[model samples]
Target: MLVDIGTEEGNSWLGHIYNLQGFVQFRLGSTEDALSFFNKAAEAFRQMRRADDGPWLVVNYGNLAWLHHHLGDQAESEAYLSKVDALMKKYPSPSQDELHAETYAEKAWTLMKFSNDRELLADYFQRAIKMQPEMVEWNTSYFLWLVNTSEHRDDGLAANILEKMRVAQEQDPENFCLAACYLEQRGKKREDVKDEARELAVKVLRNPVSSYNGMRAILRVYSNYISIDEAIALAEEALELHPDERYLKRCAALCLKRKIRYFRDRHTNQSMIDRAVSLHEEVISLYPHFSLVKNIDLANIHAKSNNGMAKADQMYQDLLKMDLKPAEKQLLYNQYEKYLNSD
Candidate 1:
């Protein structure tokens, strides 16, 4: 409309439209078209002396940053984001809490994607949260990011973030984001407080759909603390909902292995052995790579209580017959030979 009416800065409006159009195209997965439009939009914004005030300037910068990042042009992405960051600092955040929080949140997101600097992202997110502490999502994202990089430094930062996350949850009950942050913090500190972390995992499992990280946290917890029965039940439930979930399938396989080990002393029970065999077969079908981890372990599992060395040998031989990589073949051969020599 601005262009049609010959209004002042009408060309600027076209650039804004192109920028928005580019964003829409990107979301729809038209990378080439999106980049074309973004480039055009950025050129126009640069031409417009008032580009700083151009509606699409910030958004265009962000979109271009993403496009460049995906294209593996990390330098270009950082440069693009730096432009926006400079403009943002010049303009500064709004005094209003909501608007201030939004500005900081966007800055934090750009920092997260554009830089590998963990401390910088943590600072941006913390600033955003302080700007509007009501923004539970920002707090959660920060906490989770901290968890991912926790292995890098032990500045007690993870614990501090977790403490803040706990407070956020207290302020905002039913906040799955906060819950996820809390669960991850607990899971990473599992070395000292396994039981507590396991309990937290059970709670997280009850609502795994909240976030993928939360679900993974639950799986890790169950791996350590839960009984095989409980783990199996949960894995079955997860598979029922998402049959194609490879991670859950792996967990199920591990749980079945644990169950077999559990019932080893109770071998008088045939049902346990049958169930373990069935689970292992299911794992082989779902995750063939997992079944090839080691030949002896595979033989032991496949040959376990029923008959004798014959069944185990056959299973091991069948594994060896497969197109094993040299490394895999060596591993299996070593395991098979070791077992043979042991008895």
Candidate 2:
């Protein structure tokens, strides 16, 4: 996944990817790759800030300190630790917080990816944005993160939150993903966004493909408001434009799943089921780390298809045999119960 990000994104994001990848490698017990990634992260940060070093390197240096300590190099560890201390003394946090603004921002981004602690995550983002108002991406990313994280909520976003998002969306004109999210929130609040969604869809389709290109979010808006068939068509068009892009594939599959799983009254055709099944299977292959969720989606898709209960049943049984974490096991159990009740 880090390899997919490459260095095409902004310098700060590239450094973030490298830093997270370094930590993942170390956790996997590959100290050499971890060291390499940490060095790459330092360089990326240097390029991002247009300097050799800054408070941004605080986490990088701290990572180095920990890595060296684990490697039994007391001198190296102490040297890196001293570097961290000097950096902190020279460039203290902008706020009363113990961590620098950059550190807070990075921690917020990292934690958002791995955890669901809503209050802690929102607080970190708030601190980072308040301290470093110049970093526009942080604000946009924070808004988008909030929008995405609150997807399963029964109640939609509040008016004040929407107003703040609208302001942020205006400030960062180039972030189409945030724009799509704003539109989605408005639609959820019973606003008329059909024409706006159509225009945004055209613009997103024209833009170069990216992780934050807004296509996925746009598909969601279209699937919910404009037309599910059109959403599937849009996803297919994007996938055709970039066949190897796993993100696009996931988007296509998700659009198809929504159409099949919910809008079954709209011409429940064989080709749609086959396409959804195939796309989910391919998505499972492309993102093995997230297969549990995809696999459950696949099973549900099968259950809704013609004469596919056996395959779906067997898949659920297979998942039951795997050594999943407690959370995943509980989710599977809940979903399975729903699947059985549907019968």
lDDT of 1 by residue, 1-343 (tens): 1111111232323355566567668788898988998887777667764544532367678889998998789999999899888767665665544334545565565565447977767777777788677656566566656665653443335466567767766765554434544554555565444565455555545543423325544554455444456556767777677676555655666666666654455533556556556656665666555668633454675555667568778887787788878897898888778767753
Candidate 2 ranges beyond 4 A from true positions: 1-7, 94-97, 206-211, 321-326
Query: lDDT values of the candidates?
Result: 0.60, 0.87
lDDT of 2 by residue, 1-343 (tens): 5544446545347788888999999999999999999999999998888999799999999999999999999999999999999999999875564678898888988887788888988888898899888888889989988888788764568889989999999988777888999999998988889999999988888766766788988998898878998899999998888898887898899888888888887576988999999999999999998899999999999998889999999999999999989999999999989988985
Clashes of each: 0, 0
Best by TM-score: 2
C-alpha TM-scores of all predictions: 0.46, 0.89
